[model samples]
Target: MMKYHPLPAFLSACAVSACLFGGHAQAASWKAFSAEGGQAPAPLVLPDLAGRDVDLSAFKGEVVLVNFWATWCEPCREEMPSLQRLQQKLGGRGLRVLAVNVGEGVPRIKQFLERTPVSLTMLRDADSDVMKAWRVRMLPASFLVDRHGMLRYQIVGEADYDDPAQQAPVLELLK
Candidate 1:
């Protein structure tokens, strides 16, 4: 019988995801893509850094940026500050940024946050179930959900959230 080690499996998955997304590395801007007839994705329910259960459904009637990331991914780390700035700029205007961390402990995440210091919703995906649910084949993949909970756009690589072009798509969704 073969045994499964979490670290190897996690690393392998990330490696493959990164390779698949490497071609899109030049895509530094968010691209707008609507789901079929604006059909929302599967329900996402995960615990926040505080251990409180946060449901994606709860964010209905608001524009939400669901970003899948990890503390170990350099690109993921790089894009976080922009996300924070985006959050700060539009948060009061009904924009919510949910940074879903895949396969990391709270202590590690907390440590990273201490250094990065982003004030946004941070969710823990210790099992990467949410990552697979969202079909996030890459680290730092992001999706834009409209006010009606429909997924309207997705970014497969690191993005400059502060860019007017990137903010425009999200801003329009909030309207």
Candidate 2:
């Protein structure tokens, strides 16, 4: 005879809830990389949808937002348009947003974009290698890099980039 353990079931439910709602539960704000004792970001060189290799180091003199997302992530899908708006609002002022799709083929990404339609630079991480290197545990992870190529802040989950408060960090970095 086996005793039913409520604790295990409770924990499992909690984990699922966290995955589904954690991003929204978290305050939508940038966390300072230095304050968290995070190391400089790893070298990032990935292929764009056009098969052109895009390197993070090439944008050293500009504020870069590297966003990790996937087609299946609801929060990621919800937040992408806002990211596009952010780019259009700030691109001329030296802000570049790289939307990296993790573990998805270009065709699927293209199909998603066909429906969602964002003009932000799209990059592919077909094997999720970059996601692992960046220690991303959730969808919609965003990193803000300063003009000097140093990582300044990070957002662990979905954020409305169109919001003034969210835009403030990118604006500050541009200066």
C-alpha lDDT of all candidate models, in order: 0.83, 0.81
Clashing pairs in 2: none
Tens-digit lDDT track for model 2 on 1-175? 2233233332344335436765667655788875543447888999999999999999989999999887766778889999999999899999999999877778788888889999989999876778778877667789998887888899876799878989988898888
How far does residue 173 in candidate 1 sit from its true spot (Å)?
0.5
Ten consecutive residues with minimal summed lDDT in candidate 1? Answer: 1-10
lDDT of 1 at 116: 95
* Every model's TM-score: 0.88, 0.85
Stretches of model 2 off by over 4 angstroms after superposition: 1-18, 35-39
Per-residue CA lDDT of model 1 for 84-169, tens digit only, reads 99999999999999999988889888989988999889999888888888887778788998888888888877788877887888
The Cα error of candidate 2 at residue 88, in Å, is 0.3
Clashing pairs in 1: none
